[model samples]
Target: MNELLSSAIKALGEKFGGQVSEFRDEVTLLIPPDKVTAAATVLRDEFTFDMLSAETAVDYCPQTNPRFHMVYIFYSTTLKVYLTFRAHVNGDDPKIATMETVYPSANWREREIWDLFGIRFEGHSDMRRLLMPPNWEGHPLRKDYPLGYEEVQYSFNFDEIDVRKPKGVR
Candidate 1:
């Protein structure tokens, strides 16, 4: 609702046909996956959203239309305003263009998303695991990723829990 944000939104809407959603005074521009880099470039170069504050993804599994939503947060020091961009990625093969070229700080954030969500970033300089081990089999953060849960033992259910728990070699 601020003057700068209003102008930015109008400029973006005119340049790129993206859907704008506002909640709690925060604006989110929903752009296509392929236009992420372009939109980010415009935001940084034209609107002065110079800093890429954070980049992350959310998994909405079972909703194949857009299984994941890639979220990017930007901040402008001069204007002291924040803007967010969200791009929906298909579930079949979740992938999107990298914004590293536009925002250098996005390099590691992209890598982290790749490592945790199995979402690939096309044109990434180094597309490798940022947090998980290189040998790690699957993305642990995915909604479909299997979790290893241990049975809880209590005074009354100790025997029942022990029967379900995995045994270790003595």
Candidate 2:
């Protein structure tokens, strides 16, 4: 398995001009934005990685160009192997082609990534908020987003004597 993964990664790096940073039994293909869909297709069809395990995004803010990333994890029943691919996008304009055409299960996962990270999944049949309420404002998962919370006060025993803070502690 390791040997096959290595050979695949090597061939991909040579053909696609990507840096094969990590490869074990599961191959990790770090791809550029323009080649993401093509790379995914190759992995799914040629490499026999058919299953779409997950589609998610990662924010790497405060970095140079393309500070965010979207990851896709695939598993192949025929090959009995796993493969991962990543595509980087500008934090300000985080958008990428949807894999739902290739793997229908990606519809919800892509929508989730958009709802959380604001990563637009182009070509997604229906893109909407999956976890957050419909009226929610910002993408809560973004690094720059505030935690939006408010403090609340409650009294367990109103009948009991009122307690006051120590003289100087107030």
Candidate 3:
């Protein structure tokens, strides 16, 4: 890590406890859910991570201890650097502090995460579905979410498919 980023990470670690990991030239900090807002502010003001490039989520199903991970990507235009912030949330009622206040662009990104991953952002002004319908029951992106796809019928199974086909179907 460069001197500036290292110093910033040190400051963040001092103020709020977090674990840092690096891979393929990407630095990711697994910070607490509650400290996200404050930490983002500090990074934006002091470290020059002015842009919230992207906000997304990852689901680790069947592991309730940390069922989901909210991935935050920050970009520093002047420094030409990218930093990642990750926060873990449990499967049951996963919720995290809203980044919308700090990064206005997070509005839709957070909504998309909520819609797909079912991870709610506390204090978000508008919490609603982004891509899915309002009445959608379960988050489709979840591993445990039911797959309702129908099996495709081939020429070999045409007889069987016709037997099950609707009476008035084309």
TM-score of candidate 2 against the unseen true structure: 0.79
Tens-place lDDT per residue, model 3, 49-132, is 999999999999989979998899999998888999998898888999999999999999999988988998999999999999
- What is the TM-score of candidate 3? 0.91
CA lDDT of each candidate? 0.89, 0.76, 0.90
* Candidate 1 residue lDDT tens string, 16-67: 7778998998999998788878888888887888899999999998898799
The most accurate candidate by lDDT is: 3
- TM-score per prediction, in order, is 0.91, 0.79, 0.91
List the candidate numbers ranked by TM-score, top first: 1, 3, 2
Candidate 2, which segments miss by more than 4 Å at Cα? 23-26, 150-170
- Where is the poorest 10-residue window by lDDT in model 1? 9-18
User: lDDT tens string, model 2, 52-78?
Assistant: 988788888787368788788888787
Lowest summed lDDT window (length 10), candidate 3: 161-170
Model 2, position 103: C-alpha lDDT score: 87
What is the Cα-based lDDT of residue 67 in candidate 3?
Answer: 93
